[model samples]
Target: MTTIDVKSRFEAKLLRPAKPGNDTSWAFVVLPRDASEQLPRRGRTTVEGTINGHHFQATLEPDGQLSHWLQVSGELLEAAGTAVGGMVTLELAPVKKEPEPDIPPDFQEALAATPEARKVWNTTTTIARVDWIHWITSAKQLKTRAKRIVDACDMLASGKKQVCCFDQSGYYSKAFRAPEAESF
Candidate 1:
């Protein structure tokens, strides 16, 4: 339950896609490095915070540049009546409970159509489910996403409980990798 409070302006930045051929419309707000360093974890952490007095619950994720940030959804910006460059008062505390992501309807239907996959999905922990959802949704193209959904269902039906060969925490993901220093 560590909490940190800071008053700063919201910084507008585009989150470049980690994978090539992915859409580049992802935008986010940069969290102050000073404040971000106070959190308990360097990776994604469930955070309950307020922006301009509007309460929000979100995950603070690493920005792949040794920094952390929160995604600024259009709803949040509208609710706060603030845009990208507006000054905001922020207060954040780590939430003890992990929040589950909403599964897309198509994905849900795919699981329903596959009983074996549904059984495996039901047995997985909340965090595991979240990771699966994140990986599937990370695909930028509709075709890719649909393919991922089918592949996920097939994998689960085959008794696999997690998304193999993927960095679930995103630490080693292309966007979050440590920069290579120039050789002497």
Candidate 2:
């Protein structure tokens, strides 16, 4: 697989595509020279426009092409008497990366809190941590992340690493108690 890295906060000229917003307009997307495939997955990358002050969502595909979707409306096109596919520069600004959460503190705290959690956290490999981080951070809502964290913690305590333990009944415990553990 061929890979081209686009730096975050860099600009590129539209060559093949004649106008901005053209289906082919992405051919000229100027990535923030520092952009990276390693960038944390977020909803959409956006940047301010020099022409209209509109906030446009920009995306960099794996192939190094750029795509932009209109966020405001038809006002800009009408103002310029240009078509939707008219050439325009889509500026891609670097998104502020969030600081990495300290791992040892979280691991230590979970270990101190529950033995099962400690085992799970300890048994988890580096890849698992990366997956969990990406999953949690990608969530747009705080509540969703919190819920996922709770569930992840519960799973950890139950001696399961993600899908390996999620049963059909959604119950983690194998040792079922009579009335308390029964699910109807």
Candidates in order: C-alpha RMSD to true structure: 7.0, 16.1
- Whole-model lDDT per candidate: 0.69, 0.40
What TM-score, computed on C-alpha atoms, does each candidate reach? 0.66, 0.33
Local accuracy of candidate 1 as per-residue lDDT tens digits, 5-101? 5333343433333431343233355667766666666656667777777888888766554556776576777776776445666777676678876
CA RMSD (A), model 1: 7.0
Q: Which candidate number maximizes lDDT? A: 1
Q: In candidate 2, what are the lDDT values of residues 1-184, reduced to their tens digit?
A: 2122223333233233333343432223323324433344322332333322234333322212222222323454444344433455433343343333345454345457777776787677544554454445444687876666666677778877653432211123321111111111
Question: What TM-score does candidate 2 reach?
Answer: 0.33
Candidate 2 segments exceeding 4 Å error: 1-112, 163-184
Off by over 4 Å in 1: 1-27, 33-45, 60-62, 73-82, 169-171, 175-184
